[model samples]
Target: MQIDIRAKGFELSPALREHAERRLGFALSWAVYDVRKVAVRLYDINGPRGGEDKCCRIQIALPGTSDVVIEDTEADLYIAINRAVDRAERSLARRLERQREHRHARQPVVEITDDDSAEEFEQRADAGVFH
Candidate 1:
């Protein structure tokens, strides 16, 4: 998967960049096959005046599904990045699970037997037992 990291309102240091990359790589490894790209944006919301203004936004692009976007804010940028990655992981898992369930719920195929007639097939099709 491709990862793009961006920093806003501050210069991004090598240590911080490496930390974010490592954390995200580990966190998203489970859904690596499903993920196409990841975009991470780190923001210093309050600039020099620090509060709970560190924001991390993570956007995951998944195949055949809508992108999952997660945002978290904390006093520490590392904590915000961690929380956002965790949330993104959970969101991607849930979406994949739902898609799997939907796919498995499709109508089953029907095999014609000598004893079965056209009327039987029609009835079964109407009742959604056959597709």
Candidate 2:
């Protein structure tokens, strides 16, 4: 999966990039579908108190399904990113389960052939020429 990190009004450092990549990778490893790409945007939202409000928004792309987005705000960007990624993973799991259930429900059932002895059955059929 490709992880694209974008920082708004701030320069992304190597540490932040690595942290976001590692955290998102670890969190979404169990996803059922191939995450085609992940977009992470970090921004500093203005607060009334003049303190920087860190926000993280993550969009996880799933094949054959809609993308899941989760956003979180915290005093630390890393924490916000971690929380958003976790939420995205949980949402994807739920979506996958629902999709699986829907597909299974639409499956057609086939009858099973219970005959265990095929040779005997064929022999009996052949002998029916006498009957």
Q: Candidate 1: misplaced stretches above 4 Å?
A: 107-131
In the range 1-131, model 1's lDDT, one tens digit per residue, is 99999999999999989999999899889888888999999999999998999999999988887899999999999999988988988888899999899988884767778887899988987887753
Candidates in order have lDDT scores of 0.90, 0.81
TM-score of 2: 0.79
Q: List the residue pairs that clash in candidate 1.
A: none
- The C-alpha RMSD in Å for every predicted model, in order, reads 4.3, 7.4
Best-performing candidate as measured by lDDT: 1
| Maximum-TM-score candidate | 1
Clashing pairs in 2: none
Model 1 lowest lDDT segment of ten = 107-116
